[model samples]
Target: MNTQTYMQKLELLAERSISSYSYIHSLLEELKPLLPFAGACCTNIDPYRLLSTGAVVAHNMESIHHQLLTYAYGQEGVHSYDNMTPSHTSVMTLHCATEGQPEQSSRYQDILQPAGFGDELRAALLYKGSCWGYLTLFRKQDQSLFSEQECQWMVEIAPIIAKHLRQFSLAIPFVNEVKLRSPEILMLSQQLELLSSNSDTHHWLDVLRQHEGITTSALPRSILTVASMALTDDTIFDQRLHTDCCSSSLPCSPIQVCVPVREHDYIDITAYALYSHTSSIQLMIAIQSASPLDILPWMMEDYHLSEREKQIVDQVIEGLSTRKIADILHLSPCAVEEHLQSIFAKTKTTSRRELIARLLSQTDCIISR
Candidate 1:
């Protein structure tokens, strides 16, 4: 193929590498005809495992020969050239791992030699900062040894195979671990859905407190923050009122809930300064065993969002006004206002300026055991 055509094919194959194992297997199959080798196989070493094999075109070799190659390479003890005994049949594996290139031996000298095999070339597969696996090729007596050009070609494609193997390792776990029918997360999701529609503030507070209790019971260390307004009408709010309630024992923090106004695309704000939703209008629950915000950095890194949205949120704790934000971002006043509206609704905040203050001040006291 032409250089440009080959590069284009490589690019397409790289994209397909991010997909499923079956797709990857198909890709390797397509690339096989271009090589001098009789067959190819890919293996993964992490967690010490072998992936699927690609289509191979072996000459006068039974499928058992290929199976034997896999068995020898797949074992934990067969990692290096020095460790392997110099057996004629298994010399290909040791040569590949040690030489960092394909190696060949006479079929007569190796077990395959007795079987009328003329030459064998083994290629080591390296990936993700470690040796992944190997691919072996065999030829009959009339066929020549693997040419230098063919070896170079195999080396060129080895890293691509490695890259795809690493990607496959990551993609598979994500697919397998996803909950296709998670009743618990689904039930919680359903409750959140109900909460999106419920307008009765008192009823919502009751449900919120019950939910908090249930969630907290499962945690080893838990802290709950409810809206101050929810507790203002209750006798418990006044009875427990003390200097320590907002400081020494129960630290007061504000939470803002921005509900979309019915008529326009604007949001209405509800601010709560208490941690317990049992008697509060808004609440922020902080499960104290781990910091939820610590997980945010990783989540943000994996997902894509507009630069403007990221900048606005990053500076939220700084208490910048929409006008000031507009000037800083070089955006129009109306555009800044629109961005702020989306931010408030998504974060369930009433005002952009108070977002940080509320997050810091809102604390749930964890009485140590």
Candidate 2:
């Protein structure tokens, strides 16, 4: 098939009503003809933090995730996915980025070369001014390098993939009756190995696996992504201090990620460093269903609410009257009413009650101890 026809097929594929996993998995497979690669890593990124939230791997690339992430956030490596901007070229091959000298890339020297891989092409999946995920395709050592034409093709199709990823981010998954109200705590080694977890942890993990359609024994990609961020943050701290162990009483700062998992349901995952007396650093991860407050900002973003609209919506959710909200924001009651109407139009709700219900669906499932 011609390149233009392949591009059209990809656009059509993105429009299909499939789960996120299916869409991305099939996307990688379909790219083999136009952009041949022996391995690939496609990961959903937390748009705000620009950190990975989940990933899909092929050709045994799963084992290198920790190291790959390390180099991504490490001092070395150009064209890091996190550093990508809207103005920057979002798609580029290592050979091109390094001026045809791939040896100059730390990631190539440390991760790719060791894995017997050559010429990596990376793309930041962006749409609507927000990055939804990242794509990295790898060729074997004996394979030819990625050409400029191939990289340009990736740039053209990236937004389509990003749009699908964004749609999937807001799409509701199969709702399971079983729910864990309290947060489940998990301990992990610095390498992100699952060390232990609360009794309820496995139940929640099962739910995640079911939703992601992953049947493997490996730790869920979301959990690892969170853990990796925690480590990356600590690593940054350690760099300034010139020490591996944090001398302070407090553990490293934590990272909290909230992602939609099921119908009107979101999961909040919190990860932080745990320093034992032995000076060994472990990662502590807490997983629980997102509270109303936790999901509010995400809903606002999803609705594409303006700053004023977001403030008004926040007050509305807080059960404030129009006059009260107007007084607080120093806006006339008429202006506040007008903003409410706009919000209603955007959110597709008629009344304040309906708006709140739509913005903050009853996703919590709390049980008495």
Candidate 3:
């Protein structure tokens, strides 16, 4: 792609949300110039819930491979997944499998060859230092491996793509079809829908709106700003304090957050920071409120943390010191430390501060905005 077109497409990936089918298609179409390929697949990861969502835009394909590749980051022995590390965007060729000789590998013989694709380029959608989503582009059997220039370009744009996806995930619930209480509300609601609608989520939302006349509209600008603050809260605060110690004037973009709006207990909003080259805009997506008081127990189910470990992390988020947490839980300081260590291992945090920030950011959206 020409420099102008390349930058323009990358901008599109940043502006668009990923909840709709067309959104996924547009993402692939935009990237075609960089690595002209036969097809593409996207994986959206929700680290909070340990969930991964897959969307594919391929013709005459089976579902198993798509399902497998969607969660490839978490799965074992997936070179394509491992290649797209935070430091680099990688082009993985099936003809040159990392597992062994290409002809001996099952993935190459069964999947890549059958699909007539030889090369796979993965650009992991990362946010907050986690692989939240993945975009994989494929080439025809006779196609050459992706060039290093393409890899550099892909890595450079990965952050922007991830930022948009985070917004898309946050915006999904906000654009739900709400009952139009007035003409003004109706007009803005439709605009919100057009601006940030997800295909499957919007379909289900439309059904609910038809079933029950519940009035919904875009969040006010004031609340959107608050939700954005509440959503990011301490996470961004810490990032700036630690990462931007020297570059004090360079402000970070306001990333999206999911949170509950005030007074209206039934409404939940996903606040997004729409970043541009020159400036950024705060957007709010509203949905029904159903946030739990404590998410530790629920997260334990996903992370498989023992009850004792969950209790320790719970106390950590409550701002209790390790000794205080130990006394409260009737455990020795050493025992508390052990559980904290385990919690850190399972949740992938290095320190108490990081742990609390991670968990709180995940649930703060529901607590208040």
Candidate 4:
């Protein structure tokens, strides 16, 4: 099929309300005809920190993820996903970036070459300035290098991919309703290896690995990103800190992040560096369900709600009646009802039950602008 036809298929697929994993999996299958690759890795990026929240790997790309993350956080490599500007055409190839001498890239020399991979095409899936994820396509040494024309085509559809990823971030899965369990614990070595984990870790790990395209043996990119953050020197990581959590005045202990596994259920991951008298020891990670406090911030930003509206939405999620919400906020019942009306309008729901269901359940087929 031609590029236009393939893109049409992608557009149609993007319109469907599906899980992020399903969307990404189908997207890769469709891209095969337009831009073939030996292997690929689609990673969900935390827009705030530009960190990998999860990843979907096809073919043998999973083999190199550990090394890739090491290089990604270790050095400023050529065409780093974080460095790429968020645009419809935010894409680059190692050969093009290195002016045909791909050897100039440390990632190419250290990671790609050894993996038997050649040219790499990477696109940062950014929607309206927020990077939702990334797509990295790899060709084998024997295969032809990705042409500039192909890179341009990827640029054209990059925004569409970003839009779907962002939309799917809020999509509710069709899976059985499994409320997030209590906090689980895990221990990791400085090298980012899983040293030990409690029994509860399996439940969370299974959910993460099942949805995140990770094998049982491999660490999910979310865990890897947080664990890496804990081990990284503050001096080096300070340059990359995008949030205010690392301000000099405040004591930042364990680095914590709320990873959205589905629409409303978020896995709160906190990584702590265990240090001894002389040096740092193993890294400890606590995993659990994110409270409404944590989930509301993302929902408010995505829905573009005001602070008061967010407060109401929080109470609505708790099944609070308008009168109860008003009592808590010291507002009259009429005022609370008015605020609820606005909240429903902004969230595209009609009644309180519908609004609550919208917040708790999967998203509709509404595509983001």
* Among all candidates shown, the one with the greatest lDDT: 2
Residue-wise C-alpha lDDT for candidate 2, range 90-183, written one tens digit per residue: 8988888888888898888888899999888889988867888899999999999988888887888888888888778766644456555778
For candidate 4, lDDT tens digit of each residue in 205-311? 87777758666767777888878776664643453344343333222367777777753366688887765433335788888776655655566657766678878
Candidate 3 global TM-score: 0.48
Per-residue lDDT tens digits of candidate 3, residues 95-212? 3445435555456566776767766666767754555566777777788776667777776666666765555544423322342222111111212223444554454344333222
Could you tell me every candidate's TM-score relative to the true structure?
0.35, 0.82, 0.48, 0.74
| Residue-level error in angstroms, candidate 3, position 7 | 3.9
The root-mean-square deviation over C-alpha atoms between each candidate and the true structure, in angstroms, is: 21.8, 5.0, 18.7, 7.4
Better of 2 and 3 by lDDT: 2
TM-score of 1: 0.35
Q: What 10-residue stretch in candidate 1 is worst by lDDT?
A: 182-191
